[model samples]
Target: MVETMRRRGSSKGRALDLIRSQGPISRVELAEITGLTQATISNLVRELLADGVVSETGRGESSGGKPRMRLEINPASRFGVGVDLGADSSTFVVADLAGTIIGRLGIDGPGALGPADYVRRMADDLAHLLDGLDIDRAAVVGLGIAAPGPIDREAGVIVGAPSLAAWSEFPLTAELSRLTGFSCVLDNDATAAALGEFWLGATEVGSTYASVYMGTGIGAGIVFDGTVYRGSRSNVGELGHVSVDARGPECPCGNRGCVELYAGPHAVIARAREAAASGGIDLEFTGVAAADFAAVAEAAITGHPLALALIEDSAEYLAEAIVSLVNIIDLDHLVLAGSAFEKVGAIYVRTIQHIVGERALSRHLQHVSVRMSVNGTDAAALGAATMVLQEQLSPRSLQSVTLA
Candidate 1:
């Protein structure tokens, strides 16, 4: 009897995980997949439904019986805010429990604002955006800020982000909370993007995955065994700092031959500017201009020799880093994200896919799925919004908050 009860309890727990990850399933389908009795599935569904996490979304087509009511996550019951603080810009998105962006505000960053002033500016921006939204302020469960880093997630501080020099040791979470009067959570841009994908993008897939953010710099977010792993100091996936060249140029992170010094958007743009200047060509990549790497890439696609060489070199450097990563993590999938990748991303995807397919050990186990993020160019911002949804809606994250 006790063994039977234990199995029943285990089934319920698995059911909850599924509902949280892939919910709105009917009792019959749940039973078939979970191998639990329909009665047990019904019991747990009732509990979740009562807790206001799940709701009926009309009836599904019947399969030789009365149609079952379709269940779905109740996004309106809770909501969270996502803030993506990037070198070039900042974005704010308010998301419901279902990871839907009901209201959004994208802001140009105060590039020169220091930590204190930046937070204050962010506060004003957030307030202005919130005021415009038709949502009830009370249902906003928290705010999740996705900032470039080195970061200290536990302390809620952004530490030594090169792009936002003023954001160093910035108590962004506290300041934003003070400004908006809501609980706030903070994470590195890549990590938050990983969570965004894990929770909303690849939630239907396997447990382990990586979200690679290819922005001004390269960073990765790791989801392992169904949880976001932030590492020792929330600085786990600083992949850009990986030394791919022994005699390469110096990096701001005090490393020589770091990948960022070679392949990051800054590096690519610098190369473009250098080429333009040395060749006496008329091209401008100065001051807040989109990186010329994209233009160079386009030129390469059209048979421009110089542009093709530059992109190929960048892709090779990226391939080296990605190959190393696949060996270490053997990830089930790799999501290429960020604006840098958005423009010339195909080259990256194709190049990395070829290398990893030909080299990584996991190539035999399963062909590593290297694909562009569905969120595309605005992924960080969208993921920033998703950060809110995960915290409020995901079961594990929900445990961290105390609802008022």
Candidate 2:
């Protein structure tokens, strides 16, 4: 955000990424981690200090000589905006350099609106949200969006997301930037969740892991050595679209028997509603997919046989996709993130654990740890905000940006 700055793959950027991940650390530790000489580390640290990007937190314990000055990201130096556009609701958050969310807001989701209407309403909500949070608007650098994919991250538009069909080919970043007067960037929600986990969630640095997110559709985001991996399409984590059966129901993403077809919130809710229609265990139905799915999960948790069966069925289907993901990425840690997991996450976790534990190819080499995101439903939104922190930590330019 810091006024249109984007620095990547630079020595200074590397130093900053390390500082955020591994600080209150010392320059000596930075040098050791980066393998840069002490002199070079001092130079980079000086530049960062001059930019107000870092500060000395305190003195660390002495080994032999005087205590070393501990360093960390200056939380007050910059702030970022993150917006998660979901089928049920949109989440907005503002986070500072240290990865703490200072403010958050949630509003109705896209529903049936086309891109134009949705973006217009979203921008209005964002303006309202910022006006109320007690933060310096001038300190806000840029905006980040977490949305359904496959997105053209370079182009700032949804390319071919079946769930967001109306948004395909729409230049969301350009329009949002114009409306808010803040430079904007967009990424897949699941990918953003993974990065959010990296930026704010407690995870081992340099460890290879993946976050499987279930929102309107299922997806995943992978991180290795603290950077989110963007495949050729900048849409690396479309796990939902992965086909499990060649002859099953066709998905809008041009596949048959996709994971989402059998296991996504929409499918699970549809199944629950069908059971209710047949004089089965009735659960409350809301037109909103996320809310309705939550009802089903709640029913399952409370011992409704039909609800439990439906949720477990979704879990089993997801395990098939996830076991394959474990083998493909060789992932050792997995986070279940997003709205669908909030109510009955343990069921999905239990099912996935059993399947992955027994069927994963890497089961012999390592054990996969399955857990829920501490951020819960806010994972994608928080991850969206952290995108700004990532950009500022490695900025390449110094242009000033203004907000409306």
Candidate 3:
């Protein structure tokens, strides 16, 4: 009896995942996809419908008889919270079962605060966001937090983060779960962004791609064969530390000429500040680095030569790293995402496309495609939400949802 129940639960999870991934599908299609009998599909669909997990849409054309009823995951059946914990700020988002953001909030991050205080603040913000919404709190399945890593995902601990030192060795997932009274999951920001693109962006199922996340730092999230290619320790895809120049400046990671030093937002803003100080560029300087980067991005978009030069220079370094990555991974599609790409993303897109097209090792074999993320700055947060959905509803293990 126990074995039968477990099997049924597994089948139910699979059926729900199918609806979420390729919904508006008929029972016949589900049976075909799952290799289950028509009776099993009917039984599963009936249970899902009764549970409010799925709803019948209209009907599809039939072969010879009556039209078949189409079914989809009910968007209102459940909710998930995703948090992007950044160096300077944290973004909180609430998403429905359909992976749509229904509400969002942002607050200052744990810059100087200890682990306990940071967790309390996050829980309070999450509670406030949920309380303000009209949805049922009981329907919330879980919370997913995306933070900068080297994380100990299995242990649910933030092992280390360069900027967020106070969070290191912190039991982030357990603390969040305790404070929020919901199960919680933890993932690196870049990996979450990659999964977000795969789950919600335009990528086709079973396609191999990489999302290069450029925020305070640079990293890549690699998804191959419908799963994130998290390396052995889940610390893969640290593309920022990839060496682009042998004789360039030293990196904190004990490397010379890491790509992040040249292409990260901080680097771009630092260069912009230097340019403004040189009196060659007639742009106003905001002491705030993020604001300064935004001004420089605006200038670049408006055809200012100096600002354009700074952006293009950053893009060039990024492109070089991308070319090397593509050659190694044999990837054909690349996504640029994160807060840094919120403005003047097109310039980076164009530069990366041009360089990859011209210099990729497989240029003669296939054309590489580069595009901006649909979710833009919110990709990580959205991906974090998707992680919760995947963990709760999907059959696949999220152990694969890591950096590689």
Candidate 4:
């Protein structure tokens, strides 16, 4: 009996997902896409309309006699929350059923706080955000968290974050669920960004690509044929620690010349400071690395030779790393996103495109395209919210069921 109920839920969820993605579509079209019988589609659509999950948008053109009624998701039926916990800051966003961001909040450099304090603060912030929006608490389906890796996602523990050491082995998901009274899902920030792009960006379904997310560190998220390529243990795509120079400075990951050392924001700022000291250039800015990087980016954009050189050099190293990644993954499209790329993304995009065009293994057969994220710095947070939508509404197997 439980299995039968689960199957019914799965079928209903699949129908809802189809409508969300390909609506306003007719019952015949839904059947065609889902490979379900017309009767099953009718039954599902009826249940959805009765439950306020879907609605008849309008009539579609008829082939011969009767006009078909089209169906679409009712955007106000449910909501999802996404949180991006970065090294320097954390972002919270609330998205409605149609994947629209309705509310957003941020806390700068929250990693300095202990785990318990951070979680409490996050819960409080979430409450404030929902309350300010005047949204019904019962309407929220789930919350999705985008945090740094390596994370034990199945166990709902953050094994360790290079930026937030105090969060190691923390039961983040369970704690957030307990505090918010909503089921939560956790994923690496980069992977979440990829999912965000898939759901909200202009990419078509079933297209393969890579998204390189630059925050306090660098990581890549690989999407193949529309699904994130999470390796065994759900901790794949640690592109930063990939060794680029065998004889360079040793990284905390025990590798020499990891890409993060040369291409990350801190590395760029450190190099800029050194150049400023030697060349007698006054590098004035607040102590925050993100702000300082922004200063450098503005200088580079304004054609300051020293600033341009520093940014170009960092871009070169990043390009080299991306070339290797594209060659290995055989990806044709790449997205550069995160707080680090918020200002200087164009430089990185241009440099990476030039190198990949000349160096990628498949360059002879196809031109690789590199571009900035359409969702901008909020991609990870929005992706976190989409994660909840995907898990609760778009399960891959019809036999699998999860309590939301």
* Model 4 local distance difference test score: 0.84
lDDT (C-alpha, whole model) for all candidates: 0.74, 0.85, 0.86, 0.84
- lDDT, ranked from best to worst: 3, 2, 4, 1
Ranking by TM-score: 4, 3, 2, 1
As for model 1, its CA RMSD to the true structure in angstroms is: 5.0
Tens digit per residue, CA lDDT, model 3, 1-404: 99898788778888888888888899999999989899998998999899888999999987999999999989989888999988778899999888899999988767678889988999998888998997687899899988877788778887757767777888889988999999998887899998888777468776789989887888888898777887877777888899998999998877999998998777888887787788867777655555677888888888899888989999999999999999999996999988888888999999999999999999999988999998889999999998898778764533374442
Q: Write the per-residue lDDT of candidate 1 for residues 67-106, one digit (tens) a residue.
A: 9987777768777888888766677887766666777776
State in Å the error of residue 229, model 1: 2.1
Which residue pairs clash in candidate 4? 88-109
Question: What are the root-mean-square deviations of the candidates from the true structure over C-alphas?
Answer: 5.0, 5.0, 2.3, 3.1
**How well does candidate 3 match the true structure in TM-score terms?**
0.93
User: How large an RMSD does model 2 have?
Assistant: 5.0
Name the regions of candidate 2 deviating beyond 4 angstroms. Answer: 1-9, 395-404
Residue 121 error for model 2, in Å?
2.4
Each candidate structure's TM-score, on Cα atoms with residue i matched to residue i, is: 0.85, 0.92, 0.93, 0.94
